[model samples]
Target: MTIPTLEDSGQGTGTAGEARRLAVRGDLTMAHVGAIAGPLRAIPPAGHDLAIDLSGIDRIDTAGAWLIHRMVQDWGAAGVPARVENASPDADRLIAEVAANDRPVPCHVPRGNSALDQLVRIGNAVFVITENIGKILAFLGQTLIVLAQTLVGRRPLRWHAVIHQCEAIGVNALAIVGLLLFLVGIVVAQQGAVQLRQFGAEVFVVNLIGRGTFRELGLLLTAIMVAGRSASAFAAQIGSMKLNQEVDALETIGMSPIEVLVIPRVIAMAIMLLLLGFYGSVMAVIGGGLFCWVSLGIPPVSFIQRLQEATPLSDLVIGLVKAPVFGFIVALMGCYQGMQVTGNAESVGQRTTQAVVESIFIVIVLDAFFAVFFSALGYN
Candidate 1:
């Protein structure tokens, strides 16, 4: 790399060289960029072989390396064989890295096909549904296994937790459940009176209210409300435990989260939903009776007689039988989603919402199935 060069004094000229080649020198860095930039640009670029010596460079950095690179590119464009000599190994590596990374990245462009896009969305939705169903079944099996372990081993069901949960889910829920059912009952009786009066059948309002309240609306609405309230609560509590690593800590210590957390809620909901369903049905009946007595001039005693005569014991049995089943589905969905929650606050909130949605959906689907089954059995 022997090339004569002037000692740099921030002058943009290279050292005097044999006329056959141009040379570069000085600290080719950002700080000295202005001194070198003008002189380098002013040099003629011919489509011929060219050489430059960097041995005179006192120091170099990324900016200086880039500047040298840019000059070489310009010479290359003009068909000159640009050679950089005597650069430090570090400077050489930096320059090579920058050049390699300087190429433009390839981008993917989506095609415009509305039909294909819709098909893709439909396929994805089906896949997600199937995957969710599989997860729920797997979790249900795991819960049952844990329940058997509790029954067979020294670990027993946590009654204290179940009692507390029952109070929370049942006792605390009663007021709202009663109030809403009372309103529904009033609406039913009012509507039935209006429609039946036109047909000279106004006295049948008690029968209308009683049969619907006990057989379907009572337990169905109770389950929906529980799905909205307790399902989210279950998911949120377990999700928070998961987020805080408490669930993992329990697992690490060889304790079952399902036994400790899930079973109690499951038992509580199972017991409470039955009680709540019956209670909700009674409240609805009372509310409907009140409306019938007030508006239709029917005496309370007469309304009770009509209800007993028209609605059989089958309706009450149906509602009670569905309660535990609905509770089971709600608990399964809530606990499965909670267990799915990862160590993130966002996931906790997301799983809680998903739990509520899934619980409500499953309850409705089960109710539909029960309706069809009872119809097939000629029980309703």
Candidate 2:
């Protein structure tokens, strides 16, 4: 077989100067295409049209055709018209196919009006947010339907999965939740005592601790912790299952992925957050009481008496009422983001981060709304 070679045909000097020509000789297969590719691309733009002669090619393949098509495209892009000439039927067909498959990269042109561009970007962002909110609402409806079915005995509750998730979400998280709330309680008591001591009312620090812990800190902080820990875990687990097509496999076996996967997680989060929230409140109160005993010289008994008198049943009720709702929001956002994952590992990571962020944001927003609502009802 002849070795592949690219030879430059001398430029014509006629009145109408002919285009420069590059003739490719020998087998233009994968094995030889690489050798000739460099020289072909090195041909200078002599301020004339360009022609690639392929008739001298002993054999040709897709690789060679691609090389020829790329050379023509490169020259054309440089304002030098280029074409293939004297190609055999097979070579011509292959080159044509390669050329047809070459797609130009899109160029982004800046708009003249900066304000208009900004407005367009803002509109697109708003559209994406609205679309995502719609999707989340639809997911919420589907989950509710599945939950209702389970409640009515139409769908079987997966007790095993629920128990597993409860252990993972609540039991495993107990230490961190208790520690954080305890520290926060001590800080709040110290700060409150400092302020109240100015007016010789340092004893009222108990009221600050009790009311704050039961009404807001305990449940709100616990929910945020759970959102960071359990929400990200849920998104990662479900997203991985999706990437592996295990979700599809369940569907193939006539199992509803939502019923099997989502319901158990949601139920477990609701149940466990209730318990965790109460436990966290007790821990915070204990920390505050300890701080008062050591720093403010208020004995435990005195602190307890003041706490009872100052923190009402209404405050406790408000916190408990918010727990399960916050839990549901966390679980729903995680699962929704998980279900949205597609493509690859990067997508799973993105969804997991989104789940954590969205869960915490929604939880805080709802907490604010609940605070306003209860205040209107005279719970403050």
Candidate 3:
């Protein structure tokens, strides 16, 4: 069983200056809440701005303060301002804290766009593209400067770093590149053989495989692999370093991060791509030969003879020429995007994806350009 309890009472009035004053009184607490309801209701409704004086208040709990808070809020909502003017330091603090906590947070509303807004967005996109192009070209210039320094013996090139990248970007990637091209070669040969068999010209499958592999498919496929693997790795690695503040630490210690990081990677890609492209072309031809021998009953010797005649040394040279260019573009694009990373894990992820996509796009565009240029020059 429990006994009911009530709070200490208080008074409120209109003063000589005709100021509406609500004098807080009694031990206002949660348990005695029922006692204050009549007094609170007794206070006259808004004749003027309400000034609450807390001087007479003996005690208060959060509930009592909130009751006072509610009186002020209700008065304010009714177009009358209410303030606690004579509260004790502690009472003032409680009121202030409650007020602070109860304050409404502002909501943000997105603005509706007009036609001008759409144009502004397009303008912003173009500006960003121009800015990105400027940065990439600046990075290219810096890479060339570093290369020049290496050639003139002004700066020691990190041969060790280059070798390590070659192992990673080139040697480790060989198996995948070879396997994909080999499967592609088998498919091409099988398809070509099936069609040519109608005219009793199945032996021409070797010519088709050799010409396609050497002229276009070999280097392009190898570059796509490098873009997917090595480019993403470059962006991720550098972006991680940026996130960790290691790039700043490098500058603090008097090191050029471009030379230390970018130079080796760029050089390694150029060298490794040449070897990888050649290796991929050879594997594709071998895969074609295997398919020819097994499925078409064309002898390996006949396949080889037709391949040598079908794809001349000039075609191989043209493909090899494109390899290092693709590699340089891949590495440069990767490093450029990596350097653009802000100090965040999300930025790292975004930059890495951008690096792979941009590198692949550029590689394909360059491949298309080469095809046009060679056709115009009668290289085929």
Candidate 4:
């Protein structure tokens, strides 16, 4: 039989300016001080007296003593009479430690071992900026190189790799994107219907569905999906390579790991994203059409016709254009994080998490850029 135990049993009470007693048990460690401080800080100034009954304290440490001293100083500063009662001999010895230190304590700062320290600090800062700038430049340069290689290959194009990438990015991801876009379409249509009915303009639901889904939802959903999928994949792949020393093996064999691994993954992702965008747009439109038919009595043919009339060719162009850029970013970010993976499983997990977060950030920022750019170009 198992029974749950109560965690805390301390009680405090009664009247202004009266001493309140606290029963502290278990280990008298720094962690214990933290727990005690939470309730102690909340006590009113009128009844600010605190007494720690440490008779139940089985083990005490230096951190516990330091905490007590700080608390005493704080109460003294606040004009609250704080006293220690029932301190064990060990606790008394710890309290004596602070009293015996008479000299003015120096501030806690460590001086470095000379010129190399300064050089190392400066070099580290420079190296960080240089490395980040280099990553952007390298990513762009590598992207262009990969695209050019695909476009102007003297040998036949590697249809096999491209096909595999398509399967990974597009086919495997279809269910998730479709389901989400369908839900998005339903929500957008429902919201549009409510407001449209107010103005007796429910027929315009078709326009809302077409413009919103085709132009924004399609691109946004595709980007978010790809970012999570590809960025995580990259981090995991690179982290595994780092952990298993596969990257080192490649270097030893005089092969560029970037050219071999990064390029293929990026290319695959880019191609897959574009296809996913197209697929998402179709699914969203279908979902919105279903909503229109059910809620607004609009037939599918009329909805399509309304979408054709309300959404311009340029909107389609804008949506399609965002996909490739989003794809490139997703792929690049994944590869970058993968390459940045460190030597341990924990580090791999950390970098993978970082990659997902960073990729999503980059995607949103770039989407804002595209939104502004297209607006300026009269394409929105």
Candidate 4: pairs in clash: none
TM-score, model 3 to reference: 0.73
Q: Which number leads on TM-score? A: 2
lDDT of 4: 0.77
lDDT winner, 1 or 2: 2
lDDT of 4 by residue, 1-380 (tens): 11111122233354574566656566757655566656655654434476656676777778767666666667767886677779898798997796566357669887878898989999999998698768877877865776676568732345676677678778889999999888888888999999989999998888888888778888788789877876887788887997899998998998667666776777787777877887898888899899999878999888988899999988888888888888877877777777777767888888788788877888888888888998998886
Local distance difference test scores for all models: 0.84, 0.92, 0.86, 0.77
Which consecutive 10 residues in model 3 have the weakest lDDT in total?
A: 1-10
The number of clashing residue pairs in each candidate reads: 2, 0, 0, 0
**Tens digits of lDDT, candidate 3, 1-380:** 12222332233344444556666666777777567666675665566577777776777778878888888888888887778877788887897788789966769866777788999999999999999889889999998898889779898899999999999998899889999999989988989988998999987888899888997998999999999999999999988888888989999999889889998999899999989998998899999999999998889888888888888888899999999999999999889888899957999899999999999999999999999999899997
TM-score of 1: 0.72
Worst 10 residues of 1 by lDDT: 1-10
On a 0 to 100 scale, what is the lDDT of residue 282 in model 2? 93
Q: Over the stretch 1-380, how does candidate 2's per-residue lDDT look in tens digits?
A: 77898788766443355877788899999987889888876776655688888878899999988988888888888887888999988888888888888887759874589999899999999999999999999999999999999999999999999999999999999999999999989999999998998999998899999999998999999999999999999999999999999999999999999999999999999999999999999999999999999998999989899999999999999999999999999999999999999999999999999999999999999999999998998877
**TM-score, predicted candidate 2 vs. hidden true structure:** 0.74
* Cα distance off (Å), candidate 1, residue 55: 23
